[model samples]
Target: MSEDIEIAGEPSPPPAVKAKSRARTPTEIRLLARGHTKAALKVLVGLMRNDEATPAVRLSAANAILDRGWGKSAQPIESGEEGLETVHRVERIIVRPEDAVEGDADPKA
Candidate 1:
């Protein structure tokens, strides 16, 4: 019986060490009108690094960034009258003329 009870070649890691090896959850990312570009970039990088970010969330973030970066017009509806008004409203809300300028304009121009 003693001969059968041989010591293992390698010992198992401690419980705490095992727990520490577990994967971390990605933090929730948020972006607002202010600092939207920087925040979006950070979130993009985070999503690339973090295994926890779902494909849907990443796509949504990318879409948000593109929509904000470019002045994309709203989709027109088939109704063509009230639908057009709704589309205009969406364009007004999403697209900002102030945010269009990248930096200080030339005083000479």
Candidate 2:
């Protein structure tokens, strides 16, 4: 009887799978830099032409331009406490007024 029981099929899997899924590619990096320079130039021209536009609007437009030019990445959050606590920070650089226009001398000069 004991030998008969040992001849049974392999044991079944546990109720749950403990292993995590593999990470997949989020987004294509090649498309990010495409047309970026042209889009930035256009945004700059728009800002120069529309002095009445608010700074916030201009900045939003700039961001949009960059986002469109460079496709977004798919950043997936892992299933863990670290994922919940993760934070992303973005930094922006603004061209000073004196430095914006061509052939303009430094304000301090």
Candidate 3:
């Protein structure tokens, strides 16, 4: 009875806090940039589609649209095999002059 009363009087432990993920991910950055690009493209399309706009302004907008597709060069991604170990084999060969002459008559001597 006393132990139960003491336990009841004691406060419970605080709950465990979850660790926060503070680092920005590549996918998150890409999505954010995509949103900004889409917003810019919407404005550009509006400029190109407006009839009141000058031909030069509309032409510039049209060029912007086409440049997005073919202006930038393609980037090649470098990739290599993972979890692979390379092994090299080495061999040594030695031949002495006396050993070579032993097989011959050594006519010069």
Candidate that would win on lDDT: 3
- Reference-based TM-score of each model: 0.33, 0.27, 0.35
Residue-wise C-alpha lDDT for candidate 3, range 1-109, written one tens digit per residue? 5543547567977789899989889999889888799788988999999999999999999889888967955675545877566669898988665678556766457
Q: Candidate 1 on 35-105: residue-level lDDT in tens? A: 47676578776775566788887777677666667956698457755535432343445645566567756
Backbone clashes under 3 angstroms, per model: 0, 0, 0
TM-score of 2: 0.27
Ranked by TM-score, top first: 3, 1, 2
Report model 3's TM-score to 2 decimal places. 0.35
Q: Which stretches of candidate 2 lie over 4 Å from their true place?
A: 1-49, 73-80, 83-109
Which residue pairs collide, candidate 3?
none
lDDT measured at residue 96 in model 3 versus the true structure, 0 to 100: 61
- lDDT per residue, candidate 2, 27-54, as tens digits? 5444565548677678766974576998
In model 1, where is the ten-residue run with the lowest total lDDT?
24-33
Task: Kindly provide the TM-score of model 1 when superposed on the true structure, using C-alpha atoms.
Answer: 0.33
Ranking by lDDT: 3, 2, 1
